[model samples]
Target chain A: MKDVSEMYIPTYDDVLEAHERIAPYIHRTPVLTSSYFNELTGAELFFKCENFQKAGAFKVRGASNAVFGLSEEDAAKGVCTHSSGNHALSLSYAAGRRGIPCNVVMPRTAPEAKKAAVRGYGGIITECEPSTTSREEVFAEVQAKTGGDFVHPYNDPRVIAGQGTCSREFMEQTGGVDMMVAPIGGGGMISGTCLTLSNIAPEVQIIASEPEQADDAYRSFKAGHIIADDAPETIADGLKVPLKERTWHFVSNYVSDILTASEQEIIDAMKLTWQRMKIVMEPSCAVPLATILKNKEKFAGKRVGVIVTGGNVDLDKLPWMLN
Target chain B: MKDVSEMYIPTYDDVLEAHERIAPYIHRTPVLTSSYFNELTGAELFFKCENFQKAGAFKVRGASNAVFGLSEEDAAKGVCTHSSGNHALSLSYAAGRRGIPCNVVMPRTAPEAKKAAVRGYGGIITECEPSTTSREEVFAEVQAKTGGDFVHPYNDPRVIAGQGTCSREFMEQTGGVDMMVAPIGGGGMISGTCLTLSNIAPEVQIIASEPEQADDAYRSFKAGHIIADDAPETIADGLKVPLKERTWHFVSNYVSDILTASEQEIIDAMKLTWQRMKIVMEPSCAVPLATILKNKEKFAGKRVGVIVTGGNVDLDKLPWMLN
Candidate 1:
């Protein structure tokens, strides 16, 4: 078990600093209210549409902040990172804007669409086998070759602070929400959300919605320990990463509960978003909606906020999954 | 052929008035830009996302304006209309908010999802066979039975005036686009777009895009005569209607040309929009994009504004179409 107090959790001031640092580079994505969902679930639901954010995900905020916050000398050498998809695209886009080279170490099995997006944004891709050992070795080799700074996807304090800007915008848009439910990946988004909410609206309950298939975050929350071994497979490719030390601290201290939704429930919610809301959402982005649908009684008649994290998905795989 | 000069073409003043009248009732949908499409088509595209409009279409603007523009006596008696889908949902939603009854005549072959949306918004539906004869007969029967005021989907001067408000917002957002392309059905949207553009930015070339099978507007534009006898058979359900007298007058005078796109082109465009733009658009709404993709040379390197008119397609039918 990792001591949470020893972990580098971002403070409210850090989030505020991140907001100022990334404001010029990142988009202020809209907060949309759903009248239909409000009526269906008997809850006032405000969706922080991070699906509209740059790189088609909330990852851009953190990536841009981390990349730009680098010292001029370090930034001149450029940056490198390993990602399944969105984080790579985000870093690529952010780096492109600054005219810096970005090297992305991606699993060989990463979706072609994601690989294409990363390349399209001017990132160099170095594909490796889908395992932690291969990822580390490949990243190290790439770093040795390029002399680029390595930006950890979620573990870094700068990254967590950058993601916290989403909750800052959410609080500003809705005045204040009673509770917030966000999908937990490597715990970047939830940690940032919790940090911001704890400072601005401490009364607000921050809930983590995770896929039951990849239940590391849920298990860790329950056991009050970081559980990283034997992570199960899930359709939510974005939420597969085990929580890091820094993010686990914030999740432990600020998150009210970590709830799990079945793979079927996530797919169903994704389909509902496509059909009813007419919005394109990936399986990972559907976690909050799936969580609310599964446990409607808890959210009923309350002012709740959901972060639709991203919209990047493989179109070829969607129909088969839905069926 | 009906004389276009005798038809009641709405002016910019009429649109401005409608905008003022419906300001409190309707939402001003956002104008979204795409850098990806710009690179692909060699055109800077500004998509006026009416898919995000109230009731998920621009029909709400016309419906709200028409309903509120009515006499107190007429409004109290309520309103009625016949539509394949979008207008029915929009009218029902607008009427529901006004605390007035709305009766909709829809084709029996209409998608169940659309029927559900209309009913969900408190509309009374009267289904008939899917044909002009059946539509007219059913609409007349409903009007005779209910004694409710009729709000024609596109042909009415007020409806055209109301639809023009979309263009007013589009111009305000993009500021002097070189060209504007919109889907033409009964010519409501294009008629309104043309009229508004003529006054605000007269130099802007107004182009109407229709499905190849449902190209009455295209034929009419070429022949200098209204062609109402074109047998409709296209994926763009919204572009099935032949241009009415009032719409023909505005479209004939203000529009530069009417282009046609194949059904396959529309489907492909819809798929691309879903995958790239992360926005769900009905086949009818894809006409402008289809036109651009099919005839890239014509639109390339131009500042083109494409009105994504709606996003109200049946999800079940999407897979079958893609297959």
Candidate 2:
């Protein structure tokens, strides 16, 4: 991601305020530890369970922050975004908390379960063709008619600051960790981790984990520039997006490394977590542990804080159950 | 459960000692709440997530207490049990924690996942024909050969005392609840709850939940005597066991009601829990919530503590996925 603005980079104070602003609406999700994972990776893992976050992901923090951070005049129009995943439902949840309308522009081909989730949270969905251009075009019309605030899932400073609170709370909860690892898609969570850790605990290493199939972030980190993919497929559906300007600034400056894991490793680790840790987490959230296990020499004997990103899995459509 | 002996009924002091004994071996799992389920059932539910406990079940408390409570001379002989479920693995885990030899007699028809779990925790397994007489015959031979002490899954005084600690912790964590609910198999957990609550929080209602297909505990509660079923079938395999002497004592004395849920209702509630609470739990754990949902008028507008029993589930064989 490139720097979206020359002067509006979110500072530590913004993150502090975002924490205070969204405290009422968001959950201070618990941090869980697994001795089984710790022994497997040779790392003392403190899993920040964002899967237990409201709306079933950490995206709620950013969505709530963006919704609650709005000015009285802008807030009246409501909030709108284009997402087919947790972001859509999170934005709707935040809007519901604020008693404001939420408009979601999603592909018509999106799963009915996801569509129902969006509507379940009081979101008004306007379907678009399953293409980026069509989504943006449809979103523009919806935003124009509703005069709703556009809360980008990532890239936006408020969203970044809101996500930063996760790492902030993690740091305070665990006292401190030697390193922080989070899965990367659009780089929102990793960027937030970098932003918060760099300001408060600069010595803590920030490592971003991504699937080898969707290794755009790994490529971008190595190339010293942004590399956007049209549509890379992986079991880790949450990490299909590319890094944008605002997120890239943090990735380039603060991220220690961007590691990629094989598809098999992610699935194996995800299954192990569900069995051993007794927690339900998505495949994307399993990437960090997957990468950590693959490179045990790098993480061994260290206190590693791994972000469990979400738990919104289609139970009937489990990857292992698929042909 | 009838008193196993004329004078050896476990007292509250025994529960306190068990709590202290197992504290080092087991996890004090977090108490979780789902506002979603609360709204759906019109009851404030606080889930004591024993599913997240060591060995993925609350049985570890009793197993650990028994393991650690043994005299050094008696400990040298080791411990033994006959179980095909969480108790088998949990006893193995507890024995491993205490560096003692553990032997298990399991039906050959038990899931391979469970057998592997027992082995993972250092349990030596002896397979038996899948019947009560066969299991006892095989277990007796194994115990005689090994000179290992028999640790009944739920009937032993130490095991009941250890399970009582859960309610003790729940009372401390949530301050207190109007009613307490847990699934009944041989009545171990329910007996433990009855033991603790009757002594300390006698005002609290103790409700036992069971699968209607294997409603031995339900029948016993109404009949005022233990009802032993030769063979009953249910997806909640853990609840198929008949109430034993020790567990029957507590169930008969303190339980207000023994509610049963149909097989379909249990499956639905289990799926709802996995989806809404974002946690992985076995079918047996879902019985409490299923009964709660069925008896909404009885639980409505009241604070209820529901014990989430275990998460040792075969992910590939989820009930909904089965034909």
Candidate 3:
């Protein structure tokens, strides 16, 4: 296991290195444009579609970088993480590609489909109660038993640097956008956007979109410090996690603003994207669009880039269907 | 209106002209690949995503060609068609783009979503009973009243030439595939694929996919003649129509084979695509994937191009949601 006593921040050079290292493992997912959305919001929207990424999320970029960056000695130990969603699947996918063992500590309450997907990638799952206390305890025990190197979902410098590659591609693909909007969960994607855009295209505004139900990142951005949320509920299950120190560093320094969207708004935007754009994306991915639609005046007539984070959702139980 | 006394079969030259003409309007949609599907069927699958095309279907290619090809006088008089599906929305979209009137004769029982989309695109709808006799009768009257050019959904050479552009782009994008698979609706898309591929890449085999319930094209292919069905039923609403003379020319000559899938198989493939590919496609679009999965041995180790026909579906009532 690697030492984690001191906080180490990843730089632009690390992001550039991560891009080259993970290029073979990750997909340069297509950038899509919707004329309907463009007309509705009066803004030229370029969708960075990471929903179609390997393992069906952008987290694969980070997970692949982390797994591949491991030294020969550390690689023998494999990797471990606690995620009920895309990160768990991504880490499993990356580890499986390297032909290494991946241990996942998922909440027992996680969807059977998600559990099946992790297993589909040959991930070994250890279930825990749906609480931070239980998850931490279960994850520690699994890590100790498996002797696996820990790969934190978002806060890790390697993961953040890896996630930064998406924006580098976004900037190259779209030429340039006035603003880059992405859903902020643990702030992995947003922080990565900040880390990349702030260095390369500092003129471009980095906006963090959050679910109003779990707007800790938004609060943290306002409060000028990390604000933790306990079991905040929203249809966007991925955005419930609170931001940590590494993510907060980039968020505080580089993010222009943190906007939020309501649960109903997120659901509506998600359905709209599916209906018009013809892409299957998760509710969490809709937060950016929802906020953009709500604040049309700010984005109107500007070339905006929106990150469609992932497409890992339970099809049978789509959020809109429940209502 | 232009004369239609003789049936003008569209050639490769016409396809080239159509591509040039419609290049400005329609999207040169990206071709997506799925490793999961490739591993499952042992065939390399290249999906030409027309679901993301302008007006949410490949029909826009043909519709735009017909609408734009008209002489100043004919274009002023506008175009008309009888369709309850993608063709209606597509023609409406084309006419709207050209700043001309689009007359659509649709069954009054058609989904309200379809009616609204047609209206949203500035299409004037003339409702008739949900029967061929009623549709034809109403369509003829509407044409006589409006003095509009009758744009037959598939039979017209202009429409076929426009759809042919899709395969032209597909061939260019994929660097030529061993097989081209598409749903046999009224045979517009299939005929187009046959037209473009037969000339540019004659070595490529053309495969037509059909719903078992509406297997008129399959039966017609086997019987070596056109077999029109009076009224067939299937969940693939886009493929319920019988092939006309022009489409039959390509289907009988160029098409290597016609494959059929059961209702359950079609639905399963549609859901599987949504789940794994993370793309929103119509039930009709799923037909090719369904057929490919069923006949894996025939396509094994081959690079296959599958046309995702459209994305115009009622989201409130997805096929998998019905159960």
- What is the clash count for each candidate, in the order shown? 1, 8, 0
Query: Can you tell me which runs of candidate 1 are displaced by over 4 Å?
Result: A1-17, A71-78, A99-101, A126-147, A300-302, A319-321, B1-13, B72-78, B141-146, B174-176, B294-303, B319-321
- Candidate 1, residue A315: Cα displacement in angstroms equals 2.2
* lDDT, candidate 2, A101-198, per-residue tens: 99999878665666788899999999987656777799999999998889888878888999999999999999999999999999889989999999
What does candidate 3 score on TM? 0.97
Candidate lDDT scores, in order, read 0.86, 0.89, 0.91
Candidates sorted by TM-score, best first:
3, 2, 1
Backbone clash pairs for candidate 3 read: none
User: Top model by TM-score, which number?
Assistant: 3
**Residue-by-residue lDDT tens digits, candidate 3, A66-174:** 9999998989999999985889999999999999999999988776777889999999999998766788899989998999989999989899999999999999999
TM-score (chain A only) for the predictions, listed in order: 0.95, 0.95, 0.98
Q: Which stretches of candidate 2 lie over 4 Å from their true place?
A: A1-7, A108-111, A129-131, B1-7
Put down candidate 1 lDDT per residue, B121-213, tens digits, no spaces: 999999988777789889999999998878889888788888999989988888779999999999899888988888889999999999999
lDDT of 3 by residue, B167-225 (tens): 99998898989999999978999999999888989999999999999999999999999
Instruction: Judging by lDDT, tell me the better candidate of 1 and 3.
Output: 3
Candidate 2, residues B9-114, lDDT tens digits: the string is 8999999999988898888888999999999999999999999999989999998888888889979899999885788999999999879999999888776777
By summed lDDT, the worst window of 10 consecutive residues in model 1 chain B runs over: B1-10
